[model samples]
Target: MEDAEIIRLVLAGHHEQYAGLVQRYQEPLILFLRRILNSEEDSFDCAQEAFLAAYRNLNRYSKEYPFRAWLYAIARNKALDLMRKRHREVLSIPDETMVDQRPNPEEVVLAKEETALLSEVLHELPEQYGQALYLRYRQELSYKEIAMVLQVPVSSVKTYIHRGKEKLRQILERREIRGGKGQPIMEEIISR
Candidate 1:
């Protein structure tokens, strides 16, 4: 079922139906939070809190907006709140790789290594740039959706995404030059 339908069911007094929304977004929400907190426990807690907040504020959810974007906005706020309380800069990509279910051994290892390098480069970017890249590419959110989540204007979201991609390109070029490596890992990372 669609999020709108699930939400309508919840708002119509089928409180148990809210679980559908939770199950739908649980993994991505937790993974996003984990990137911010770098702790599985903390990420889970934040995701839980975000879901609760969403439930409590369900009535305020506008049907005009995409449910996933709205949920991500809540999750982002919850993560920022937790970070403020903890006062830490421990954000790093979790050790998760998007490998195929059935993969060649050598290809899997290379993918893992490349992913690790890409993660480091991403984290090294300025927060806004990194976040823009993550939300735009990794999460596959549209500009309008990202604007909603980031509480920014659509123009700003576009600018951020463009700059983020350019910044990533520059970083990769610098690395390639410094390493003097013939590998096109940078292109692979960006093209992927």
Candidate 2:
């Protein structure tokens, strides 16, 4: 069923319907939280809190916006709150064991290196820009949806995404060169 339908059912007191929502969103929510919190345990805990908050505030959900976006907004807020309470910076390297599944050795090694670079660069970004970029590319949220989540104008979302992409490109280019690479052979793929 569509998320809207599921939400309607959930709000109507069909609590079982919430299970479907949770199943549908759990992975993305967890992954998003993981990127922000950099800890599997914390991500899972924040994801649960996000879902519970969403459920409790269901009456305020606007049907005009995508339900998934709304859920992500809640999740993002919870993750940010946790980060503040911990008094730590965002975008640290995640624990290796926290990965949901293992890749082949070669793939895992490459992924770990890339993730470390990305994390370092992401930590350098200002909070709003970092969050916007992560939400846009990693979580695959639309500009409109992101604007809604961040409580900002759509134009602001576009500006942040544009600037964030430029910064990320610079970071990647510097890393690639330092690692003894020339222009990305997969320039097309990277651009995409």
Candidate 3:
């Protein structure tokens, strides 16, 4: 069923329909939360809280807005709340070795190393830029969708993406310089 239909059902007091919404968005929501929280446990908790909050506040959701975007806005707020409650503690990197579902060992190792490095760089970014990059690249959300989800103007979204990419390039260049490498892995990824 479409998200709007499901949401209509939810608003009509079919609370069970909320579970379908949760199931549909669980993975993406968890992945987004994991990127922000850097802890699987915390991400799971925050995702659940977000879903529950959305369910409780369903009546307030405007039908004009896309349901998924509204849902993510709730999730983002929940994540920010969690962060604030925790006094903005720095999240540690997830253990790359634990992600063992790889078909090729060599490729898995390379991917893990690259992921760790990229995660480090992403964490160093300002929150808005980091979120813009994550939403654009990781979630594969379009510029319009990201602006809606973030409740930002489309022009602001464009500016954020442009500035974020430039900042990311600078970070990669610095890494390459420190490592005595000519170009960073990001250059290769971008070129492709």
Query: What's the TM-score of each model vs. the native?
Result: 0.88, 0.81, 0.83
Q: Sorted by TM-score, highest first, which candidate order results?
A: 1, 3, 2
Q: Write the per-residue lDDT of candidate 3 for residues 96-175, one digit (tens) a residue.
A: 44646878887777667766876787777777777877778767777777887677987988888788778887887776
lDDT of 3 at 44: 92
Would you list the C-alpha lDDT of every candidate in the order shown?
0.79, 0.76, 0.75
Residues 1-192 of candidate 1: C-alpha lDDT, one tens digit per residue: 989899999999999999999998999888777777888999999999999999999999998779988988998898888788878666676656663564677766766776577678888788777776677766778888888888888899888877776777888787764244432454543554
Model 2 residue 123 CA deviation in Å: 2.1
Error of 1 at 74 (Å): 0.8
Q: Between the candidate structures 2 and 3, which one is better when assessed by lDDT?
A: 2
Error of 2 at 131 (Å): 2.0
lDDT tens per residue, model 2, 1-192: 998898889888898999898999998888878877888899999999999999889889999889888898888888889989999865763534346276677666665665565667767767677778777766678988999778799999888877776776677677664334323322322364
Q: With candidate 1 superimposed using the best TM-score fit, by how many Å does residue 11's alpha carbon deviate from the native?
A: 0.6
- Supply candidate 2's per-residue lDDT for 86: 91
| Evaluation by TM-score, superior candidate among 1 and 2 | 1
